[model samples]
Target chain A: MPILWLFLIVLAIAAAGYVIGRSRAVASVGGDHRKMHSLASFYGSNVAIKVFVPAFLFTIAWLLVQPIVVNATVSDMIPEAAIADNSSRGLVMAEVRRIADGLDSAVAAGGMSADFARTPQTDLDDVTQRIKDAGGVVTSDITAPVLNAAQRYRAMNGTGNFIMSGLAILIALGGAWWGIRESHADFRARNTVETSIRALLIGAASIAILTTLGIVLSLIFNTIEFFRLYPAADFFFGTNWAPSFSGRGGSSDLGVLPLLWGTFYISIVALAVAVPIGLFAAIYLSEYASKRVRSVAKPLLEVLAGIPTIVYGLFALLTVGPLLLEIFGKDGLGWMQAGTAVMTAGLVMGIMLIPFVSSLSDDIINAVPQALRDGSYGLGATQSETIKQVVLPAALPGIVGAILLAASRAIGETMIVVLGAGAAARLSLNPFEAMTTVTAKIVSQLTGDADFASPEALVAFALGMTLFVITLALNVLALYIVRKYREQYE
Target chain B: MMKDNADERIGVDAMDIKFAAKDVQVYYADNHAIKDVSVDILDKTVTAFIGPSGCGKSTFLRSLNRMNDTIPICRVEGDIRLDGQDINAPEVDPVQLRAKVGMVFQKPNPFPKSIYDNVAYGPRIHGLARGKAELDEIVEKSLRRAAIWDEVKDRLDAAGTGLSGGQQQRLCIARAVATEPEVLLMDEPCSALDPIATAQVEELIDELRQSYSVIIVTHSMQQAARVSQKTAFFHLGNLVEYGDTTDIFTNPRDTRTESYITGRIG
Candidate 1:
């Protein structure tokens, strides 16, 4: 049976358990529910939890562990002579699994009897032809040892699935019987059900945390592998970033300094454009704008944040790049060489980040207590002087946190740099010069046709690890500052 | 000895009027908060406005310094003069008027700065000190006048907000006094202080009466009687009676004032 059908069977058993458990609890106290330890729904939920949880857990575990066990046993059955010199054991296992599936389909289509297909003396050509006629793909002519391994793979999988279905249903039935037996007036069904629900929620939360850990572990291992192939010191300190793609073990100078410099320079330019404009906009929105104007304008300003970064990337490429090129190109200032330069991406990314800084800074500024402003005004200070000396000082730490978050966002931006900042890794102070960031280069390295095990391709993981560590540190610092600021007033 | 001296000064300085108001009315968005009220505030004395909550005593006091102008919907009408100059005139800026007439709020609100900086804020903004030494002298004088010098003199560089509630209020008083204002308006200044702090602040107020005219609004009738020389009783936005503190407590002229003092119809 299919896994979906088995899942529905377990649910049906649990549903029956719910009805029986509720009725049994009531009947135990002569149909007076007031004598029960818990409510009627609680009793029903307890029974359903018992019947569904364990059976579902078992089914999942069987599905995860069966393939490995079966593959290990069946591959051992194949002789060493069947193994080819060029292909790996994993590749042969994949072919074996595919041929087994094909044979299963051929038998299910009535092209051959099961016993006849399993006979060792049956013609391989005949079985292959029958598999092809049954609409199964055959990559090569069937060999004797591969044919025997495929048959064993099919037989083991069939037995494993059958056993899994039977055991899951048996567990469900046993849980239902035990639940109904315990469904008396004195049973603490409510507490048990509540505990189960709490466990379920904890399980959900841990899944997210565990997934993040898994991603970090994968990045760490790949980074270690890359370091083993390429010297760590050279990768970190070297200035040149030229990757030769002729083949593996070629002369490739993979340095990270130029990329780091480009990332920092572009981020500086972006923050220069974003911080002042965004901070002033936040001040106006929070402090000066009237109620009616604020209600209309705040959301309209936030609409800038909702625009996709990809759309901003296109704008940087098509519009801002050309505009800056005209002003600073040979005709205007003779500083820029082309449309794609650090200035173009930085300016456009700053526009993209305006709403980010404004929205967060606005909230932080608004969090400042009104009594401070009142105290300042009571001392005969003007409104502007009060804001400059008193209000802004109180909100400075939180605003710094917001700016750091925006800085991280600018550093990790990929599409904007790819489209606007040309794919040339260089270290220069001129904003008009084209430069590439770490994220943009990561995309280029992985999408190329290099071998997966080569250092040039594995270098993407190292770049990813570096970028992740930097952003993570920035986020932690930002959160720390924001939390410390919150403790001041409350 | 101080009470007799103050009484003798009141008799000798009967013509020293510091503030005069005529038929003043206040409105907050069409809600009449203060009715027609007129009073003369004499210099070198403490006058107390005593009333129940929401009786417009604080509202009327705020109008004296044009602090009510900060609220968008608050409006004040009629003429109010400080030192014989019409403060409502367009030629007189509210900022200058406020510097001339300072205020202390009910709660202790101090700036998040050093204690010395808190005391020097007013003098610094008004350009009363030409040098750092002069600014330091002004800070010491103000803190001493507020009667909190010894407790905080050693920690002048400490954060003003780190002080106790009473100390913070005294720091605010010092801040206000550093400007050398001719009048001080206090709105329920002792409401948030304990009995010990209240007595201390009352003593400071009595000493302050020797130099500047002080007006205080209080909810406590006994507090008003203790700290003030003149007492005004307001009920439902109306000033029912005004007289010497002894007479107002013993021989009130209005039945409303009598009922309020006797705790009958507040």
Candidate 2:
């Protein structure tokens, strides 16, 4: 309640400072030097900001300290015996308060003895009768101290409120005065204001770095815990990835090699489907196609990118799987299964990321200055020859960057893998067979009702850590390649 | 539909005379950039197009090889007869036209490839070389013709972009030469090069007149006087005067040409 009052007083002071500054400026509105920058409101705002900001900070600081100081002083007044138990003191204080309330009611009801009332009674008699009625006896000795402490509490509360609000007003007034005094020539207001803003920007940037560090550390620590019982060699080298070791009768098999194989196999398939098609589309747009063809084709290509990955996952699961199976299923070639497999998901993912790769590669290709294209054309080279021999080579670094970025996204992809890719993790060479990726396993292992303290749950973190490291390296490499590309052109 | 004037052009060029454009109109989107323009370029001669910026000299140069067609919104309506042959025929491929009429830009633009590869690109695309030895000889001969062979002969495997500015421009010329084109066009080729490189390129241009007719666009009036046999003065997208280099400089036919030549106006 006192903090609310102090806040009001501080606000009033700030408003007064703004009015005063604006009026002072208004005096010079007509003919005084004709040199004031910004506007009267901006000056008023500056004054108000100076008056309010420091006072608010100090008030919040004092509020934090007040409770701690009051608690220490109040706790010190308690007897050492009550402090020793620590637990019994709360119950004892409640009992004492109940008796005091009963005594006050008795005095109001005119049921107390005149002699007892005359002495400004200790309320001991009323408590005795009330305790007897309840069939218990908590002595009246704690009652006297309860009355004494309540009286001291109200006084301390008043003093704290007075001092805190008074300090807030004084600080605000002092700030306004200082600001008015410093309003002279050669005072760099913009520099002071921008320095504060620079500090804020730095604070915002540090948060991104810190968040990445925190995630890495968490993955590392949990993965370490997972490695305590399960050996790292078994996790990385063994083929079968059955986490249910208890069901296997002492056979514990959890391997990442199969998952890693699945990840690479799918990524390779995705790249195969994407690169030639994407690069050709990019070249056509950047080199040969007219503006009309490009305008129609470019956004149509980007529509595939706009459809969410989960939709692509559904398409893979419901459509592509069935379609593939019909062609290679029991009814036809009988080489593939009825459910999702590596090819179905990878093809869909490749379709989804085609624009992701192509648009970026297109920009890079287009950015390879028109001068280079002119140089090629002047030499009698055909359009395709020019793009293949000159433009693509110039744009190679940026294309590599775009591909690496897409690959990193693919490696860390969760929704599509979780929905479309199969659950079984086995080291296999066939693209027709169903297989699982690292992301699919992570989602499965983490969301299931496994005990948090066990190695099974902790292994998710280990997988997470491995996934983080791989993607981080891919991103850093992508950044390095992009920077080199920029340096070449710029 | 395109018109074929190759038959007419062959007979006229066999006579060793000048090609002429009667009237040319250039439009960009809907804005008329160049009004009815006419000029003549003589055989075995260096013709200079001199004007202030945006006077459409470069536009006229690009029109010679249908380079204007590369720009989507640009529209050209004109009669440009090269040796009496109307160049814009329906059966005519701009690629072939560009091959026969090569160009060097205002800025030196080298391919980001090896010097050998850069020079060999045009020959490879046009299938002008029969074998490795032939292609090598062609590449070397073109480089020697551009006058950068001694400096870059040993570094043929090095990236073309790694060369100095003057060498890069010569490398561009070599690349153009590898296609075995007939007429060479230069648009402010010395603007981005140093004085020494400019002298070297100018000297090379004089030697090139033995086989290929050359047209140059220059901002410097002194350059036109120094390197050209004939000069065409343009102002506000109009060809104001075109005559012998001596007559254009010493006694211009038009007032605008006179003011520009005398440094009164650009």
Candidate 3:
């Protein structure tokens, strides 16, 4: 196999390079005690690399081009009567291979058939991989001319393979010899390798920028496709959101108002749940907790954050949804539909965000200069007064940025909403009522059977663009607030 | 330098045991910061503490009103008494102590508010003024006392952070003064100011002696000589010398005090 030949050639190259390098190292001493350039091994490796790299590349390129070229040429030689307009070249190639196998099988059995179509198989040194239809000749009564052509063709094929592979190995050995000769003490191989590595790093750095550009452009083009089927005005302003591409005729209207409402409602609920709890917890951890308490509590809360969103989604669906339905189901206080309402998802999401808000705020609070706190305390202010008047105000900007980031995450969240916030898309005032958001609708419209070109499917892109713009705007605002905040202390 | 005790005591007011700290030792997380510091702060005169850094000048300054109690790991042992009542007594509150003895910090720490609110913060918290007009009077009086009333009277609503560095420090001084404390503690208040601001603040401190007992911790010996009536020399947490400012600066009896004042050593 090609793998085995490459391995053997590499070993021989290493040995030759080593011997040549060792000789060069010893000879350059010139009867004096001091040595000349590089070690023998370095010379040998240098020559080996010189010989192997180019020849290996050439052999690989030839191997690829030769097979395709031979296949195409032989494909033309296939029976023209058997081919048709609808027939494929792949099938034709398969037939040629089968025919060659049959010829080989017949020749090995010493029984050449009588249906031989090949008469001058070897005389014309065709470079095609095809063999003269060997199965067509009869064993004892095969035509003389046909037998000679078959043998000659086989000989030519064998000779071509030997030369191609032999040259590949020879070039590899020559490269090893040259690598050894060129090896010297001053070669700076490290710098050469590092320069190439630096180029690779630059290549990697541009990928992040390009990927962002790619996502934006892809969204814009796809959104344009969606607008072709649905009017932009209706998509933006419509109140209902029921997308039925199957044309069943009873489906409700599809608009963004319901999803927007749901996103706002859930986010409000999540903020309601997250802000007080996160802030209070952060205060306790950063200000009140002893070192021992902090050591234990910090990592435990981080573990809560590490639980995957999918697991939270499953918990909402399997546990909370049914439990709430039982408590509120048209019987007991029927004000609630199920536990997996806006409150449920928001509360769970808030719990997940506790560590994020706390850790970020904690760092910002700690970073607030120690002098400010001392100044407040020196003024005879109590611990509570100092924190309320001095530290929190100083840390407010970073906290606002953190809250904005959390809000974006809330808006973009999908799994928990999909499982808990039911498929209903309505402008309802009740938090207990089922609702859907932009991300949930995106998952729904994209997954079900719908044409990619359809307005319904393309609606996801428009939603995506909206989400992107909102998050970007929020990011700018948060950064502005944080920067202004720092300017006060700096 | 050539002053007797009676001449030195010319400006000194009769003391009624206003505030006294006895053998107070402070530790921060088991690291001994101040060891066995004892001092008395009189009613209506400027008392200056001069020392090399880490000699616990500021640490002793914080102990007069129990400000070190705010720091969780900063432990204090020994009694600090105010008006014959122990401040470390179980029922006595640190907040009340701070309200009665306000402080100016080393750096200008004006709150991120309008110049008016920065001055009015302490009064607003303590509910000192009943209405807007009364609060205005308090603000004007505090700013005037700090010698920044004319510079900022026109733009009271401008952000405190918008002021120049010296002005910001004066604003912080006005903030502490607004609380109407009987004793004012200034911890290296001029360390972050220019020489002009330092001179202005020293003039203000001289004027302040008429109303409040001012204990100042300063690095500048010239400042201590100019603004203080009484001087306490601290060396390695010990109150090594205490007497009239002129006497201590000119003819210190202690060898350590002589070496420090003469610039032979710190």
lDDT (10s digit) by residue, model 3, range B49-147: 998888888988887788887677888898788887898888988888888888988888887779998888888888999999999999999999999
Per-residue lDDT, model 2, residue A171, is 86
Candidate 3 chain B — worst ten consecutive residues by lDDT sum?
B1-10
In terms of TM-score, the best-performing candidate is: 1
Q: Cα lDDT for residue A126, model 3?
A: 29
Local distance difference test values of all predictions, in order: 0.89, 0.78, 0.76
Native-referenced DockQ of model 2: 0.67
lDDT string, candidate 3, A331-445, tens digits: 7668686666876676667777777788778878878888777767656676788789888988899999889877888888888888878878889998888888898998998
TM-score of chain A of each: 0.94, 0.72, 0.65
Order of candidate numbers by TM-score, starting with the best: 1, 2, 3
Superposed by TM-score, candidate 3 places the C-alpha of residue A455 at a distance from the truth, in angstroms, of 2.7
DockQ for each candidate? 0.56, 0.67, 0.49
lDDT of 2 by residue, A84-200 (tens): 354466554455445434444444555554234234337665645644454444454444555344334434545786787888788899988866554433344445456656866
- Model 2 chain B — which ten-residue stretch has the worst lDDT? B1-10
Candidate 1 chain A, which ten residues in sequence have the lowest lDDT sum? A115-124
Per-model TM-score, in order, reads 0.91, 0.80, 0.77
Fnat per candidate, as a fraction, reads 0.47, 0.78, 0.59
Q: Point to the candidate with the largest lDDT.
A: 1
Pairs of colliding residues, candidate 1: none
Instruction: Give interface RMSD, every candidate, in order.
Output: 1.2, 1.1, 1.6
CAPRI-wise, candidate 3 is: acceptable
Model 3's TM-score against the true structure: 0.77
